[model samples]
Target: AVTRELALFKVACTVEQRAEILQIAEVFRSKTIDITEETITVEATGTSEKMDALEKMLANFDLREMVRTGKVVMARGTQIT
Candidate 1:
């Protein structure tokens, strides 16, 4: 089976930190879904481990909120009876 998780991270950061935060998001292949003067919302989708790693990295910053969905899995190739 293949599994993937989706997460949205809301981080509070100053203008000086925006570039750094964006860089980190880019490394995680996360998309910037929203942005404001004080916060940024990033969307990430990957395996659980990948999501964990991204969370860990973002923890260094002001991780204000996070929303994650349960694992989504699908069988590989044709169905087996």
Candidate 2:
């Protein structure tokens, strides 16, 4: 079965470096979850493969921390059992 997971990235880069990291999230179609003077947290939802790619792309940064969730399965329509 196909599955998708959620990934949350907490990056500890300087204010100067924040813009570049935000661009990374934009590139991966992710969203900014939170922001602080010293860090930026982003949330992304996609297949495991895509999440892996995002991780690799951000590996060169400060990357203070990261959290990934297990696959979530949901019904797309209103059809009930």
Candidate 3:
């Protein structure tokens, strides 16, 4: 599975504009999900074209933000013989 995630955009966006920006984000929800735990996650799935668009949108929304730690992951599956 492929996922796209946006982080720290809450801190990136000025507090005054966060609400309006979030409303705008609703239109771009696409196949992604945005989470709001201690660490945030903004992930989605779709074609490269769609993913690119969503990524650009997030970048624009969080221009000053950059991935701090990058990505960390683990595989999940059952072996079949």
- Tens digits of lDDT, candidate 3, 1-81: 333333333224565656645654566663224434222234444454555565576665554433333333434465332
| Residue-by-residue lDDT tens digits, candidate 2, 1-81 | 447899998888887888899999999999998998998899999998889999887887888788899787665567442
Q: How would you order the candidates by lDDT, starting with the best?
A: 1, 2, 3
**Could you tally the backbone clashes for each prediction?**
0, 0, 1
Error of 3 at 50 (Å): 1.2
- Candidate 3 contains a number of clashing pairs equal to 1
lDDT of 1 by residue, 3-36 (tens): 8999999999999999999999999999999999
* Stretch of 10 with least lDDT, candidate 2: 72-81
| Structural similarity to truth (TM-score) of each candidate | 0.94, 0.82, 0.42
Error of 3 at 9 (Å): 7.8
Off by over 4 Å in 3: 1-11, 30-40, 63-81
Q: What is the model-wide C-alpha lDDT for candidate 2? A: 0.87
Residue 22 shift from truth in candidate 1, angstroms: 0.5
Candidate 1: 10-residue stretch with minimal lDDT: 72-81
What is the Å distance of residue 30 in model 3 from its true position? 4.9
Off by over 4 Å in 2: 74-81
